[model samples]
Target: MSEWTCAGPSTEPAYDPSDPQSGRALVNYHLRELGIGETHLVRAGEHGLRYCRTLVPEGIGVCRAYVLTEAAWPEGAELCVTVSWSPTAELCRNHTTGAIPTGAVEHWRQRIAATAQALRSVGFVVEPSHVRYSPVYHSDADLVVYRMPEGVPARRAPAAADWALTEPVPPNHQRRSWTYPERSPEDIVIQALRDAGLHAYHYEDPLPSGRVGARSITQTVWPPEADRCTWLTWWPHPTFVRDPGTGLLPDGAAQHWRDSLERIREVLTGAGLTLRTRARPWHPDTDEEVHYLAYRVPRG
Candidate 1:
């Protein structure tokens, strides 16, 4: 018989009133203070508390960022604060801040350093001296990160002043598909068509492979068929689309594809385009078929 090795209870309890997991506890605490009903704890790794609305506890004594819930933020809201640690450490500023401070070049450096230290204290063998920073603007798609902590090399923090206040893209890069009893396929197709540049409407089309019956799609573009085409198209392979009724695919690959699609949708929407979806259908025969279409609606 093989013996099992138990690391014993995590060095710390899953819950500690003093430290309480940084992200969720902070979010839950804030939501409670605001009397926001039905608020749920969203597990988003380290950055979770940053997405939540309520400010983190002021006197926690140490400085670090946490993920916040995305849906809670008001549009275009900017967070500002000065982070002080080593007293003499530069008073860091954050304007276009998420849960973490932003706009303070020195503060970012410090946080990254602190995180490196925290990781090491937890027994990660990382070299903070080699750390470096890089600032990313107009993108939060890669906001959350988790590594062995100890083995990471130093990287510079992106200058906070350089970061613009905008919604970071969701880390997972997949399309978020939701089905509602009231939302019709035609409605979705029309919305996507208008989002794109060319004028289009829902047109009849046969579905691909095992799907039954044709669903909805954008019909045509405007300019009387101009010699130039301003539209581009791509399709998700069978491996990507899963039956919502049935959750299939290996957990990791499925989640990756899902997040990828969501990222693509955000990029398209950011450019004023929409990707309307329809029910999978048959009669189109093979897996390679136009499952959906996006048309650009002429902007006035």
Candidate 2:
């Protein structure tokens, strides 16, 4: 597991607080490093402080550039310009890796250096240790095993609804899926979809062997605006079906995928949603089938 550090100067002579352009320049310099040309300025007088918010590169996170006034610090420094990058909510949702990427850290370091340089050019005294380094962890496990912080409360698992609420369904986003080792109860899946404001259904299809398979599939259809569909399939066993000769999933293991077309047909008749399905070849090794389901959702 990788650890993160957040650093800033302990003490420094502040820059001219009356001049907001200096703050803007500091933020622009950092933005330039990310190849972003857009200028964002939050006037100091209007907000009682100056700050800039911009998207980080490679969708790693977001950067906030702000000026710390002397009044806020213990030492009567004129001003301290700070640039910080924390993961964006969306990025955090999608990234399973609980650590900041090295590339992201390097980008942040370069931006911090640029912001500090901008401050120094304006007569503010800067020090090498100006940037403080404190560790940041994405989860409690990371902290307990890595940092071993004492007196931290035991982490509790977040409720499904709570977790779902944290990630808003993207607008016009047609698909999302979740697979479980065991078949997730239909009621539970339906309730979750409801809580997340998504409409979907569950269908079970037998494999090519014509035996009742141990897989449960959920197909979600977004609103007409999204014009997209997503399928989530769950296998009860780690290996759904095995290939006799190679100890891998046989090609015919996915023959049951054709049932998805029938599932879509039912949706068209029962739910009034139109969808088209096409069968592609299945991968031999993984026994993965590439089925293309396309449709334009009917507009209300």
Candidate 3:
């Protein structure tokens, strides 16, 4: 590159690319590019295309980062890039088993796309690559990101980057019992959804005598925002609230609930999880309807 040589003697303590005054940004880039996993002497005038040979069109594993030149890259390899997640306490505790979902993946994807467009504006060819999640993703995972569009002043972009993990209201914060078998998919789903920046909780039905009973969580994942009904019947169903004057539900709150469900669906599908919604009547006296959404994994 204009900053430094693509083929050079691989050396330790590589130059920092951020220091523009160094005028040798590619020294470190060359070292990292050629030494992915291990070092191979990059011959001068090699054109830097050999590194892309490992990419498979039908790659079926966890994502890995590959560097490619900007000059009209291999057609099949330029998959749109997405970024990985920032670590959380619960995330690190689980060892990233199964898939971890985050809105941040798409969040940074747009940033990279914007940066690439900025490069094109200044007369440069910018090609991106693909990325995806896999089953049982490890903590230290690989990712592909785009370079900043050069020849621009220092400016920042606006984003919403907060993962506030509040305590699960004490009564519902109980562990699973040994009576049932392995960890359920719903358990994993809640974790993935939280990592994706959605607030999800588990609510347990209390005992008959209003006492805290052993944790037997049976699909207790109704989001309060969506299931706007606050009170429920003795049976584990909502008391159908309606105005005596009009058949419409009270306060027009279920509309807000529907909006929340739509937003949650977008986040789930983005993370490659299946979400299904259904409305069913749950009253002994009359037909009263309740809406619910469920996360489902393909039967395998």
TM-score for every candidate vs. truth? 0.23, 0.24, 0.22
Off by over 4 Å in 3: 1-183, 196-248, 278-300
* lDDT tens digits by residue: candidate 1, 1-300: 222332223233343222314433333233233332123232333543322222232322233324322211112212111112221113322224522244444444555455445543533232322112323321110112222223444333334332222122111122123245433333434345345422233223312211111232111111121111122333344444544566554335444444444554564466554444433322212222233233233353
Best by lDDT: 2
Cα lDDT tens digits, model 2, 27-67, are: 44544444432333333334454444433444444444444
77-149 in candidate 3: lDDT tens per residue?
A: 2221222222322333243243345543443344345444543453333433221222122233223333343
RMSD of each: 17.7, 23.4, 21.2
**Worst lDDT window (10 residues) for model 1?**
218-227
In candidate 1, position 121 carries an lDDT of 51
What is the lDDT for 207 in model 1? 22
Give the residue spans of candidate 2 off by over 4 A: 1-224, 227-231, 234-240, 248-254, 264-270, 274-286, 289-299
Each candidate structure's count of clashing pairs:
49, 8, 1
lDDT accuracy of residue 277 in candidate 3: 30
| Model 2 per-residue lDDT at 32 | 45
